[model samples]
Target: MPDSPYVAMGPRVAIRHTERNDRAEFTRLSRTSAALHHPWLTAPSTDEAFDIFMTKLERDDHEGFLVCLPETGAIAGFINVNSIVRGAFQGGTIGYGAFAPHAGHGYVSEGLGLVLAYAFGPLGLHRIEVNIQPGNEASLALVKRYGFRLEGFSPDYLYIEGAWRDHERYAITSDMFEAQG
Candidate 1:
């Protein structure tokens, strides 16, 4: 296992960079969580696909993080910062999933808060966005809990699960966080 840096830490969970050794557990979680992720998202469930996923994370514009229990280091979920734009924009789109066993336990929510801090602080990112299909209430609630406000709607915004899907755009900026504080 490579040395993984912890992006943020909480009492019960820690958000850390995804390591190559996470393959087996991540695949198992992905396979088991199929029911929960159906139509909404899909995670890599095989070694080959996971390898490809990791390759993408190694790119400059992407980052992958694992949300893990502090004691056992078991993965509770994952979050990806995608298409990071620096320069004047200083933003990124976020994608996340909670493993079935950990769903509804608030791990993903807590972990995401850590991701937000890391993104807005050390990463120097000004804004982060999450695009959710309107029907995915769980996803919408999660972002809303983190103080992401609805920006607008996008028709056929992303191709997912073999078809174009409409999405509601939600976003939060560092300025918003400061205002909340």
Candidate 2:
């Protein structure tokens, strides 16, 4: 939390499901944050792409959340838990990104913390996994602060920027998160 000056100032944010009406703002922010995201992430930046993205979230395996400042209702960032599993394995992988205006302010951390709480509580998840490109120092630090442990590395684990990219895997279970909190 000390990593963000805004965190010290007591930033208050709310997390909610991403809605279809958010299309305009979501794509706008995605386009604006292109510089911050390129090589490290890819987000829907067009009407068609967003339509497709929204469709994917309709599935039981996927859920998306937008983090916003309650006072103004402006979106700070978004997180999506994908590939959720039930029954024996109750968990999912998370992918998140911050908008340019909110990137360094720690809204991402707040949003992530809230989402993880939801996952472990209402979602009844046993664990969650996060995958980060090795060069993405910001992402790595974000996860580390949340008590996620480095599990391993995978070569060409994800395709980004038109090429296969390596990723460092990190994971945290309900027990781990609760212990740290």
Tens-place lDDT per residue, model 1, 1-181, is 1464676898788999887788898999999998999888989999998999999998989889999997888899999999999999999999999998999999999899888888889889999999999999999999988899999999999887899999999999999876776
Model 1 TM-score relative to the real fold = 0.94
Q: Flag regions of model 2 displaced more than 4 Å.
A: 1-11
Residue range with the least summed lDDT across 10 consecutive positions in model 2: 1-10
The pairs that clash in candidate 1 are none
lDDT of each: 0.91, 0.89
Give the poorly placed runs of model 1, Cα more than 4 Å off: 1-5
lDDT of 2 by residue, 1-181 (tens): 3432122122588788887889999999999999999989889999999999999987889989888886787888999999999999898999999998888989989889988988888789999999999999999999999999999999999998899999999999999989976
Question: TM-scores across all candidates?
Answer: 0.94, 0.93
Deviation in angstroms for 32 in model 1?
0.5
Judged by lDDT against the true structure, how good is candidate 2? 0.89
Q: On a 0 to 100 scale, what is the lDDT of residue 84 in model 1?
A: 99
